[model samples]
Target: MYYDIIVLGVVVSILFSELTRLSPAGLVVPGYFVLSLHSPMRAAYTLLIAFLALGAEKLLGRVMILYGRRSFAALILLSFLIDGAIQASGIWAGNPGMIGCLVAGILARELERQGIVRSLGALGVVTGVLSLLLLAMGHPVFGTQGVWR
Candidate 1:
C-alpha cells in the first residue's frame, strides 16, 4: 500500500494539540474549576467537553492517526516545542487553556502507546467535561482560589 503524508500531517496536528494538556495549564486548574462549580453548570460543561473530545477524536481518528503514525518521528519533538510555548505564554500573562492542552498531549501519548487510538479523543472529551464540571463546582483543582479556604 502507498503512504499518505497529508493524513499524517492532520494527525500530527491533533496529537500536538492533545499533548498540550500535559502542562499545568490543563489538568489542575480545570479540575479545581470543576470543584468550585455550584450546580447544573458543572454537569453541563463536563458533558459538553466529554462529548466534544471523544466525539471529535473518534470521528477524526483515521485521519489523525494515519498522518500521526507516518510522521511519528517528529511527534514528540513538536510536543516539546509546544510545551515551551505554553510555559512562555503563561509567563507573559496567564492561560489556563494551555494546561488543558498539555494534559491532552500527555493523554494522547499514553493512548498511542497502549494502541488505543480512540483513547486520545475519548480523553479529550472526558477531560473537557470534567474540567467544566470542576470549574462550575468551584473546586479550583489548580485555580488561584485556595481549595482549603
Candidate 2:
C-alpha cells in the first residue's frame, strides 16, 4: 500500500507538473507528504525543517556562493543537521522517519526556485488530491491501518 501510494504520487506529480509547468514540491515530495498525512505533526515538522533549511540557505547565500550543486548539497546537509538536532533534543515524540529530511531538502530547493507561496500552494493541492484519492480507494488517510489488510 505504501509503495502503491508512492507510485501513484509520482505519476500524479509528473502529470501535474506537465500540465501546470511547475513541480509539486519536487519529484518525490508528494509521496512522502501523502505517506506522512496520517501524522499531521510529522508533516508539519518536515515543512518546518524545510523552511528552516531554506532560511539557512538564504542566510548563507549572502556570505557564500550557493548555486547549482552547491546549493543542493548545502540544503541536504542542513536538513540532515536539523533533523539530527531535533532528534537529539527529543523535540518530536515519534520517529517521523528519514523521509522528512529528504523531503525537506527537496521542498526547500523547490521553495528557493519557485516562490514559497507557489511551491507550498502546489504541494498543498497535490497532497489534498492524493489524500482524496486514497480515501476514495478505502485507504486510511489518518491512521495506522494499511490499505491492504
Candidate 3:
C-alpha cells in the first residue's frame, strides 16, 4: 500500500508538473520521488541515468573545448536533451518520470564538475520563473493540457 501510494504520488507530481507547464526541473523532480519508492529499481535506474549524463557531459565538454564552442550552454542544453530523451523512453514504457531525479542529479553533477556552480543556482531560479510564465501562458496545473499530453 505504501509503495502504491508512493508511486501514485510520483506519477501525480510528474503529471501535475506537465499539466501546469512547469519547467523541466519540475518534471525531473519526480525521478527522485519514484526512486525513493524502491531500492533495487531505483539503484539501477539511477546508474543508467548517471552513466548517460556523465558520458554525454564528458564527450560534449571535450568537443566544446577543442572547438572553442559554447561549453556552458552546450552542457546545460545537452543535460536537458539527454534528460528529455530518458523521459520520453520512460513514457513509452508507461513509467513517465521514472528517472526525473536522476536527470536533475546527473545534470547537477556535471555542472559542479564543470565549475558552473553559480549558473546552476541560477538555473533553479530560472526554472521557477519559467514555470510561472508557462502557467500564465495558459498552461494547466494538473492535467492533460501540455504538449506531452
Candidate 4:
C-alpha cells in the first residue's frame, strides 16, 4: 500500500510532465510529499530544507563550476547536511523531521532547473490531484494519522 503511492505518483508525474513539460518538483516528489502530508510540520521542514539547498547552491555556484550532475550532487549533499543538522538539534526529536529526506534534494534539483514559483506551483497541483485520486481509491488521505485507513 505504501509503495502504491509511489507507483501512482510516478505514473501521474509522468503524465503530468508529458502534458505540461514541467518536472513537478522532480518526477517522484509528489508521492513522497503526499506521504509526509499526515504531518504538515514534516512536509514544511522538508520544503524548508529544499529551499535552503537551493539558496546554498546559488551561493556556491558563484564560487564553483556547478552544473549538470555536479549541481545535482552539490544540492543533494547540502540537503543531507541540513537534514543532519536538524536531526542533531533535537528540536524535532519526537519525529525524525526529515521525512522524505532525499526528497528535498530531488526537489531542490527541480527548483534549480525551473524557477521556484513555477516548480512549486506544479508540485502543488500534482500533489493535490494525486491526493484526490488516493482518496477516491479508498486510501483515506485524511483523518487517519499515518494509516491508510
Leading candidate by TM-score: 4
- Each candidate's clash count: 42, 0, 4, 0
Q: Can you write out model 2's per-residue Cα lDDT over 3-99, one digit (the tens) per residue?
A: 8898999888898899998889987898888887667777888888889998988899999999999999999999998888889998778856455
The TM-score measured for candidate 4 stands at 0.91
Angstrom error at residue 42, model 3: 4.2
What overall lDDT, based on C-alpha atoms, would model 4 receive against the true structure? 0.86
Please give the CA lDDT of all the candidate structures: 0.39, 0.85, 0.45, 0.86
Q: Candidate 1, residue 130: CA error in Å?
A: 1.8
Per-residue lDDT tens digits for candidate 3, residues 78-113, read 556765786676643533332443354534454444
Tens-digit lDDT track for model 1 on 2-105? 01222332343355447654322222333432333334343343333333343345545557663454433333334445446645766434333322333333
State the local distance difference test value for candidate 3: 0.45
lDDT (Cα, 0-100) at 123 in candidate 3: 35
Judged by lDDT, which candidate is best? 4
lDDT of 2: 0.85
What ranking emerges by TM-score with the best candidate at the front?
4, 2, 3, 1
